[model samples]
Target: MKNLVLGVNDAIYRACIGVAGLAIVIMALIIPWGVFSRYALGQGLGWPEPIAILLMVLFTFVGAAASYRAGAHMAVNALSDRLPPQVQPFLTLFVRLAMAAISLFMLVWGYKLCVATWNQYLSTLTWLRVGLSYAPIPLGGFITLLFVLEQLLYGDQHKRRVVDYECTEDSKEAV
Candidate 1:
């Protein structure tokens, strides 16, 4: 059962990484083309900016999920680390609960935003719906919620620890 859950988590992590990487690469190419078309061609494309922004949203939100799973997100562990070993569990639990609350907010409000803007169209790109612009917000929140649940149940970033081999002695030796 643990192996199955971990396998799913690993798959999600890899998918997030791949999506973020693809979004970044596409943004890189699009930005340059937008610049070239505007200055060199004297006819700026109308779609590039919107597309780039969407891609950035994709990269940021998905990348954040991946980072959180890997324990790469910035965290203030200094104080917690100094606490007595017995107190550490409580501290970690408190922090995770706080994180869960924030994730819930993002999920709720983000989805609200998406729904609110559902009828609206992008000014720059008429064909695109404005609701889609806010997709990353809810998506990222949901992804984070999944990770947080995993931690709350299993303790710590179990998926990434295994996926990244963070617990291996060799990694510590290198550091």
Candidate 2:
């Protein structure tokens, strides 16, 4: 049972990170195209700006979840490190619980916001529902919730230092 749960959790983590990576890649390609089209080609495309914004939303939200799991979020490492080892575990749990609550709030309210605006369309992309734009909020919350629960149950997988988003020993075996 433990192995199965770990396997599933790891799979989800990988998928989220993969999607985040793809979003970044897409943004990298389009932004340059937008700039080139405006200056070099002398015909600026309107679609790329909005597309880039949407892609950015995906990148930030999805990447956030993966970063959270990897303990890569901007944290006060200096302060946390100053604390006694015995007190750190409980302090970490307290922080995780607080984060979990925030995630739940986002999940519930963000979905409501999405549904409320479902019938509306983007000013730029009229064919695209505004609701779609709001999807990343709840999605990010959901992913964070999963990661928080997994950490609570199995303990943090971020046992070693991770440099530049690369997987550590704990994460590599799962992949």
Candidate 3:
């Protein structure tokens, strides 16, 4: 079960990163193209701005899922590191479960928002609905929740053992 969750999450992470990177590349290329065309040729690349904004939105949320899988999200690890050796495991578990809960909640709520926005067409492009732009919310949240759950179940077992001062000969100072 753990492997299954990790496999799917990692797959999604890789795909999302690739798509988001492509979106950025497209935006970068198109913006310059639009500017150069308008200024040099006197004809506007009218589609670029709208397309760039759409891609930018995709990049933000897709990249967020990649960050979550890579454990690149912002966190304060200081307290966890300071925890006593015997308590570290529990602390780690707690943190993972907390993250999973939050991700799950977001997944549920984001799906609702996506559904609500489904029928509304984008202002700039009537052919494309706003739901298409916002679909990443539920998708990213689901991927993140899966990854965190996988880590909690399988990752902790593989962690390197840490030695603390209390477990070493330095503890003799108290006696």
* Alpha-carbon TM-score of each model against the true structure: 0.87, 0.86, 0.74
Could you tally the backbone clashes for each prediction? Answer: 0, 0, 0
Worst 10 residues of 1 by lDDT: 158-167
lDDT of 3: 0.75
Among all windows of ten consecutive residues in candidate 3, which has the lowest summed lDDT?
A: 157-166
Give, for candidate 2, the lowest lDDT window spanning 10 residues.
159-168
Off by over 4 Å in 2: 160-175
Prediction 2 global C-alpha lDDT = 0.86
* Model 2: residue 150 alpha-carbon error in angstroms: 0.5
What's the CA RMSD of model 2 in angstroms? 5.4
Model 1: how large is the Cα RMSD against the reference?
5.0
Residue 21 in model 2: shift from native, Å?
Answer: 0.9
Candidate 2 per-residue lDDT, tens place, 53-141, comes to: 99899888888988998889988868679999999898899999999999899899989999999999999888889999999999999
lDDT of each: 0.86, 0.86, 0.75
